[model samples]
Target: MTRDEFMGRLRRGLVGLPTRTAAEIAADYGQHFDDGAADGRTEAEVAEALGDPDRLARELRAEAGARRWDQEQNPAAAAGAIFGLIGLGAIDILILLPIVFPVFGAVIAMLMTGVGVFIAGGFALVVGPFFGGPGGVLAAILFGIGLMGLGLFMIGLMALLTKWLIDATVWYARLHYRVLKPALEPSNNRSQD
Candidate 1:
């Protein structure tokens, strides 16, 4: 494909992205073509080296999502990042959806369970003294403290796990992109020769 055709397809593929972002991406790819030309390559060779514009757009979207999630760490950004990664491969969706959903569900359940335990502990701490004699009140206070500690620990652990999950997903997506990228480069070299 010529540079104009390649950029047109890329711009179409980047439709949902913010205008500035899409323009920046287009300019970046345009630079790639310029660089290739300086190295005595044709627009078609550069386009081929870059791979399919639609696939490139998808990968760029995934990278952008990952970057946004890293910056914001919000649910919306996380969802965008996850869906972008999943969109990269049908095989990934087929293999990962079942496992990912259950793991996330377990994390959420654990967090809720932790909160419930903490609340129960607070209730016990407050009401136990009212209901019981001296030794019983002391035992209830101890139990409440123990329960609260356990709940806090569970919450902290879950937070760490959630962070790790996001990091792993980003890593996997980047790894997938890197693995495919070199396959295109050799063709560019062969075309040059």
Candidate 2:
């Protein structure tokens, strides 16, 4: 079947599911059908490869039902978990804005640095010979070197912080999946049994 047709069938099969859960299952089943078709399978073969829709639908319904019951029993915990996740994602994106858009960050940094260097150079060029001959030039040289070093240091520090934040977010997502997947499965098949 075409992708849309397959999705329609899957969506109908999962009619009782929560909207988010139904959409996820439909999308997953659609991808499965697409993969099968990519291997030169006919529509019937792809549908068969996805297996009996009724059985899949039942399993999904059971899982969702069990999860809902679990959430109901621990409403506060569920709310905290869900909102905690949303908050974390929001925080990560806010922090990553400048990091991922480094061009903008770099441009701003460059503009500031250019203005700083120009002002320092202009001062040094105008005042160097009066202070202590070559000693004045040395002082200006030292000051310029220090300003560039400080700028580089700030850039490097920001890069490291961004990398760490991104890595932490990835780790957090993987940890959440690992914990939640098994939690969603009924213990000892109690619900189905």
| Cα lDDT, model 1, residue 86 | 77
Error of 1 at 68 (Å): 3.5
Clashes of each: 0, 0
1-193: candidate 1 lDDT, tens digit per residue: 9999999999987887778998999999999999999999999989987889988888788888889889988778888888777767657568777987899899989988988888888887888777885679888898788888888988888878887898887788778768866764446566668
| lDDT of the candidates, in the order given | 0.84, 0.58
lDDT of 2 by residue, 64-173 (tens): 54355345534343333333333334555566556546754665566567556656655655565467755566776666566566666655665455444434534454
Cα error of candidate 2 at position 184, Å? 4.2
TM-score of each model, in listed order:
0.74, 0.38
lDDT of 1 at 142: 88
